[model samples]
Target: MTDQVMAAIDGSQFSTAVCDAAAWASLALAAPLTFLHVVDNHPQTAEADLSGNIGLGSREHLLEELASLDEKRARLAQEQGRLMLEAAKSRAIENGVAEPGIRQRNGELVETLAELEDDIRLLVIGKRGEAAHKASEHLGSNLERVVRSLHRPILVVPEAFETPRQVLIAFDGSKTTRKGVEMVAKSPLFRGISCHVVMVGAEVADMRSQLDWALMTLNDAGFEAHGEIRAGEVEESLRSYQQEHAIDLLVMGAYGHSRIRHLLVGSTTTGMLRKATVPVLLLR
Candidate 1:
C-alpha cells in the first residue's frame, strides 16, 4: 500500500493554503492524501450562574440559544471542510493523485490525531488554526499541542508559501536526523529540489567524514545535495544560511537527545522554530 499523507483541516481560510501544500507533497510522494476535519467537542460555553435567582424560562431560553448557536457553528464547519476537501481533491487529481480521502470526526483534537498517526507518513497542519488571526505570530493552541504531542513529521505551512524550490535540512548526526534524511531520500516531495545539508557545531576533526557520509547518502538516493559544516549556535548558523541561500523550506528533527536532556539544556529545535523565516518540516 502507498503511504498515507494526513492533513488536518479546520475550515479556516488558512487551511486552504495548507491543503495546497499537502496536495503538492502527496503528488510528489506518490502517497494517498487524507483530509481530516476534527470538530472540537469542547465548544465555547457561557459562564454558569452561581446564584439560582434567575427564572426558569430565562435559563431555558439561554440554553436553547446556545444549542442553536452550536448547531449553526457545526453546520458551517462541516460545509467549509467539505468545500475545501473537494477543492483539494480536485487539485490532487489534476496533479495525478488518485482517490484522496476526506474524513470528519467529532471529538477531542489531540486524541483523534493520535489515533490516526500510526498509519500516516506525514502530518500536515497550518501554522495556526480556526481561532488564530492572520496577523498572529504565534501558532494556535491546537497546532502547538499537536506538534508537542505527535511523534510524527509535521509540515507547518505558512501563509506566504505557494511552492517550495529549495530545502534546508538541519543535520546533527542524531537518530532523528537519520530519519529525516531517509524521509527526504524516499519521498518525492523533495525531488529535483536543491537540498543543503547543514551541520552546526562542527569540530575540524570529524567534519570531513560527517560531510562525506551525508553527501554519499543523498547522492545514492539520486538527490542533488550539498553539505556545509559550520561552528557556532545551531539556530544562528541555520538562520544565516537560510538568508544567504534563500531557502524556501526547512526540514529538521523535532527533538534531539532525551526529553529530560532537552528540558535541562535548551534545544536547537525549539530555537529554530521560533526564529525561522521559512516554512519548517519537523520530524520527530
Candidate 2:
C-alpha cells in the first residue's frame, strides 16, 4: 500500500498550522492525509489500593467513587479527542486535502506513532504540544522522542503556517545528512523550491568539496541550488542564514551525532528544533 501522510494533531495553538502543513505535504507527495490524535491514558491507569483501611465499608465506597470518576474522565478525554480529530479533518479539507482520514488512539504519542510508522510516508507534528503551548522557548516534550523512535521522516512545524518558498539544508558531511540531501533531490515534497546547502566549519578544501557535491547533486536533480560555508556554531550560523535568505523550511539529519557525543555537548537536532521559527524536516 502507498504510505499516507500522517499528522499528529492535538488541542494546541499549533493545530491549525499542523493541518495546513499536512495538507501541503499530502498534496506535494500525492498521498492520502491522516490526522492522528492520541489520548494519553497514563493519568488514569493505576487503580488506587484501598486495602488495609480502618473501615472496610468506607474504603469500598471511596474506591467505587474513585473508579467511577476515573471512568468519567476517560470518557470525557476520548470524546474531546474525537471532536479535535473531526475539527482537524474539516480544516484539512478546507486546506485542499480531499477526504482526509482521522484516527483517535489511546496510548503515548511516540509509541502510537511507532506502531503506525509502517503506514506513514511523512509524519507532521507541532513544535509544541498542548502541554507546552505557552512555552515558546521549549520544544514539545514528545518531539525529540518521536524523532528518535521513528524511522520515517518527520516534519516539525511552527505554530503558524506559511507556504515554503525556499528550503535550507544544514549539511555536516555525515551519512544521514547525505541521505537527506538525496531525499530532497528526489522527493516531490521539495520540487521547484530553491534549495540552499550550507556547512558551518573551518573553510577547508574538503568542506568546500562536500558543499560542491551537494550543489551538483541538487542541480542535477533540477533544483535551483546554492551552497555556502559559515564559521560559527552550527545552530546559530544556520539560523542566521535562514533569516537572511527568508527560508521557510529547514531540512537536516536527525541526531546524526553519536549519543555519547551529544550527551557531552548537545544535539544539534534538538537545538535547531527548539529555535527554528520555520518548519523543520528531519530525516533519519
Candidate 3:
C-alpha cells in the first residue's frame, strides 16, 4: 500500500468526524491525506434507452423527458459530491492536514474503494452514511462491503472524534489478530499510547499463553501494554472494559477464522461495530 490516509466523505453528519479522524491518523502515521467523495450510482439516475421501439406517440416524448430528468439528477449528484469533497478538505486542513488531496468519482462506493485499495495505507470512514443516518442501529450501507472488499486497515469513526489516549484490542490469538497486534506494535499510529489486549474466556493455559505472548510482543516494542482475560459474553465484556477504562479506540481483526468469520454474520464483531461509540480500527 502507498503511504496515504484516505477518508471517505459524504455530506452526512459524520463528515466532520471522518475528516477529524483522518487528519489525526495522517498526522500520527506521517502520511499524505486524501478526501474521497463518490456520487453513488443510484438506479434512479441510470441512463435510460429512450430510443427503444416506442409507438410514435406521447410515450416517446415521455421517455425522452425521463432520460433528460435522469441526466439532470446525475449532474446534481456530481455537483453535490464535489461540494462535499471541498467541505471535507477544508475541515481536514483546519484539523492540521496540510494539503489534503481530493477525489470525486461517480460510481458505487465499494467499487471505487476496491479500485484504490492497493494505494491506500489506511481508510477512515463514517460509521453511518447519509442513507443510514435515520437508522441509528444500522451501519453505513457500504461499510461492511468496503471492509470485506478491501484489505487495508479501516478506521470507522463515529459521529464525534477525539485523539485516542487508550486503545483496546479484542485479541483472540488467531493468526489475523496476532498480525494485528504486530501491526499495532510496529505502526507509528499507536506510539506512546496505552494499549490493553483483552481476550474473553476462561483463564486457561492456552489463553494465558497467547495473552502473555501478546504482552511480550507489545512490551518488546516499548509500549505500555497490559493483558487481561475477561469472562463473559465477548461483546459485553469488551464494551464494559472499554467504558471502565475510558478506552477511546477499539482494535480488532476482521474476517478471521476466529469468531469474526464474516462481519455481519451475527458475530461479536458486528455487535461491537454497531454499538461502539469510539472509533474502531479493523485490521485484516
Model 1's number of clashes is: 0
lDDT string, candidate 3, 1-284, tens digits: 37799999987898899999999999999999999999865658444555557655666777778788877888898899888888888888888889889998889999999999888999999998888855666887689888778889999999899999999999999988999899999999999899999999999999999999999999999999988999999999999999999999999987644465444423777889989899999888
Q: In order, what lDDT does every prediction score?
A: 0.77, 0.88, 0.88
Q: What does the lDDT read for residue 100 in candidate 2?
A: 96
List the candidate 3 regions with Cα displacement exceeding 4 Å.
45-56, 257-266
Candidate 2 Cα errors over 4 Å, as ranges: 44-54, 261-266
Ranking by lDDT: 3, 2, 1
Better of 1 and 2 by lDDT: 2
Rank ordering of all candidates by TM-score, starting from the highest: 2, 3, 1
Candidate 1 regions with alpha-carbon error over 4 angstroms:
50-52, 133-136, 256-267
